[model samples]
Target: NTTAAAVAMLRDIPVHMSYSIAVIDRQGNYATVYVNPDRPAEVVERRVSTNHQHGVEWAWHAETTKSVEREAAVEKLLLASASIKDVLSGFQRPPAYQIQYGHDCGTLYTAVYRPLDASVELVWPGSLWRQSCADFQDEVRTIRFNDGGSGGLAPTFKEGAVSS
Candidate 1:
């Protein structure tokens, strides 16, 4: 997966490029990449997220007010963040900043990846867990609802950790 590859690359080399990469492992381990072409070897080492947003190779999706609001919220957090944890906090639920796809889709989990520690914290709609990079596997974790309320698309998982 691209996200896994990105995290692995970050661990092994200086990833400086023009694009964004988001990776999450089975244990909710994740890494988001923000690259700048001008500085092709420097990693910002921060947290970032994306949802249905367009990129260089993709066309912009139909933007709704909600999507714009979510993007704005993320950007605001990123700009005001003083630490990586602060940025990760933006993905937390309650106010429902995390996106849900509706009855057929729901917010399954939110993840935070710390490259410095090579650790990932996962937030399920009803639970939470953490995993280390060394223990991570390229497998998807599935959560089954007891109420037969099946909803949520599992995010992809990637392997490897960032080594400073």
Candidate 2:
């Protein structure tokens, strides 16, 4: 069912495009669909993608150096059973994290999802959002970014309950 849904979604996009999408459900069911322009979709369980065509030879497409680095780091983290916090930190690593104010495409936020609980935590430069299926409240938890222009520094996560 997951695979079918993923394929349907992929087909919805106009053809002749290289893309990847992660589809997940609260029951721990998930699928990542990869498609190269003019090619069929393939479902991959363990993969790292950053705006490039996957499931193909590296020489066939242009995968940025930073994307490669981040993918490798994620593979290592997945092997080590890293927590969501650690994964998010890895994403903030050099060349991967971006905060260009004037750029059209820069890192705006990072998200951590625990499908079993249907909980998601979204982290931005100055705030965080945490919610679960049980509690539908919408709130933004402000946090401090101590990077000082340096990348890869994890935001100073706050303790205690979220404030209103």
| Predicted structure with the largest lDDT when compared to the true one | 2
Expressed as tens digits, the lDDT of each residue in 113-160 for candidate 1 is 655568777865445567887786554555643322333223333333
Instruction: Please write out the lDDT profile of model 2 over residues 31-118, one tens digit for every residue.
Output: 6788767767777774556655453356323343445655666677667765766767666654456443333334556777767777
The residue pairs found clashing in candidate 1 are none
**Candidate 1: where is the Cα deviation over 4 Å?**
1-20, 23-49, 52-65, 83-85, 94-96, 99-105, 135-164
lDDT for 31 in candidate 1 is 60
Compared with the true structure, model 1 gives a TM-score of 0.44
Clashes of each: 0, 0
Q: Deviation in angstroms for 153 in model 1?
A: 19
After TM-score superposition, the amount by which residue 103's alpha carbon in candidate 2 deviates from its true location, in angstroms, is 4.1
In Å, residue 157's CA in model 1 sits off its true spot by 21
User: CA lDDT of each candidate?
Assistant: 0.51, 0.60
The segments of candidate 2 whose C-alpha lies over 4 angstroms from its true place after superposition are 1-4, 12-17, 55-65, 101-105, 138-164
